[model samples]
Target: MKLTVLGCSGGIGGARSRTTSFLVDDDILLDCGTGVGDLELDALRAVDHVFVTHAHLDHIASIPLLIDSVGESRRFPLTVYGSPETLRILRSHIFNWLIWPDFTAIPNRHRPFLRLQPVKVGECVRLGERAITALPAHHTVPALGYCLDSGAGKLVYTGDTTYCKPLIAALNQTRNLRHLIVETAFPDEQHGLALASRHLSPSLLGAMLDELEVSPQVYISHLKPGVGERIMAQIACYAGRLRPRALVHGEILEF
Candidate 1:
């Protein structure tokens, strides 16, 4: 299976888009962002399931647009998976009539285009030939990281999180972790703000990596716009004994 970096920036700007990533062939979307519009209609249509980490706007704002774009041609209900609190925020706040039209009840409510599924922590959910297990993370709201086990190799995607014990522990359980896609949203100079917002800075991310016993190829993403250079340099400085690289849009990895 191959994973595509649809969008990986922390915020939007020139050459940088919000957070969205896709596991191709599997039809599993890690997150949906404004950048999702870049995908062709046929590509968007192929998406069967979307697993959200939390209810943050950057991560889920494009769900409404995506479903709306698919419109009448959508034959099956799009499955939206997330934690209970995350689902609640999406349903009661984002997908509710206030922020956006609730597609889950659109098209006569009986057979709507969207289906929300709440996935609890540690539970493994089937996604075609693979199984995704939800792992815990440190974020402002209820958040989760996912480990996709395809039997061939495991791929872990840490949605948006700070350095946490559970995250390190989860990575330790996997034997053949092919790729580790984590986030470092800011430079070490912004550690205070990063910690306050429950995001990782370069220094924090490096310390987190020291806990890992496995040697998965690390791909760092979610750098704030215009600061990628500074953040990347700091991350590289402390990347000793670990293989790490900054993630770019269109970067594809197969396992």
Candidate 2:
């Protein structure tokens, strides 16, 4: 499986600063953030499934637009997978016609442009030979991370979480874990804010890593736009033993 980082910044400022989104192979998306907008119309139409991590705007900002842009060209409805609570939030707030048209009911209910599927933690949804499993996440909103198993190896993405023991435990149990893409949203100076927001800072991330049994290649993501360097420097000072590197936009991981 080949996973490309569409965007990894916590917030947007310039062209390179795009919110979280990952393109999995060709037909799957990890999140539909602003980074998704960068895809061409044909590429947008090619997306058959999206596994959302949460309902935060940064993570789902382009979902509505994506459906609106490609619903007509697609032969089958686009499927979105998330936690029940996250799906509920999307139904209640996003696809409620007030904010955006409910594509699931558009044209006809039987064969609509979109579909929402709820997945629970530990549930693995298999598409072809690839298996994507929803993992536990502790964020401000109803959230989930994911484990992408290519059958050959596994790549884990800890989507916007703080210090979560269950997530660590789950990762520890994963066989052939090759890459770990975790979040460190703020610098240690903003540790209090990070805690309140249920996001990890450098110190917290270091602490979390100390409990890990598996040593996958660590890639840090979701760094706030301006303070990315400072946060990464702090990560170097605190979590340098793990040798975590910043996840960059357009970077691809093949396993």
Candidate 3:
């Protein structure tokens, strides 16, 4: 399977910088961020499932707009998968009519425009030959990383996280892990702020990498737009033997 990077910045500033979002093949979305807005109408309609990492606006900015744009044209409801806490937050704040219309109940409940599925850590959801599993994450909000196994090879996306041992353990156990897309949100100078915000800095990321057993093609993503250069330079010094390159806006990874 091929995974396309739609947007991978932690925050947006210019035309090329967009918040986190990734498209797996053509049918699945890892997170529907601002980058999703760049897709054509038919490309938007092609998405059948969205697996959300958390309830953060930067990660889910396009869900409401996406559903409104193509929900009526689709033959089936758009499925959005998330953790229980994340879903509760969306229902309470986002889809509660005041923020955005609850498409889960729109056009009659029996055949609504949207569907919600709650997935727990360690749970695997299969779609045809693809297996998408929710991995552990430690962030400010309820969050999850994912491991996508395409039968032959695997790719792991560690959606916004701090230093968490469960994540490292899970990664070490994974087989055929071809690509690992991870986040290093801040530079080493902002280590204190990064810890407070439950994000990873260069030092923290290196510490995690030290425990890894699998040597995948690591690609660093979700850096704060302005200070990406400094963070990456620090990563070069601290990130141990695996020299992970920065993940670009439109980069694609096939596994």
User: Where does candidate 1 have its weakest 10-residue lDDT segment?
Assistant: 17-26
Put the candidates in TM-score order, highest first.
3, 2, 1
lDDT of 2 by residue, 23-75 (tens): 99999999889999999998898899999999999999999999999998889
Worst 10 residues of 3 by lDDT: 235-244
Give the alpha carbon lDDT tens digit for every residue of 70-121 in model 3: 9999999999999999999998999999999999998979999999999999
Provide the overall lDDT of each model, using Cα atoms, as 2-decimal numbers. 0.86, 0.94, 0.94
What's each prediction's TM-score?
Answer: 0.96, 0.98, 0.99
The C-alpha local distance difference test score for the whole of candidate 2 amounts to 0.94
What's model 2's lDDT at 228? 94
Query: 131, model 2: CA deviation in Å?
Result: 0.3
Model 2 ranges off by over 4 Å = 239-241
- Note the residue pairs that clash in candidate 1: none
Model 1: residue 186 alpha-carbon error in angstroms: 1.2
**Ranking of models by lDDT:** 3, 2, 1
**lDDT agreement of model 3 with the native:** 0.94
Model 1 ranges with Cα > 4 A deviation: 16-18
Better of 1 and 2 by TM-score: 2
Write candidate 1's Cα lDDT for 1-255 as tens digits. 788888888888776565655545547788887667788888888888899988888888788888888856888899899999999988898788888888888886789989999998899998667889999999999999998887899889998999999889989988999999999998888899999999999889888899899989999988888898899888878846786888888888888
The residue ranges of model 3 lying beyond 4 angstroms of the native Cα positions read: none
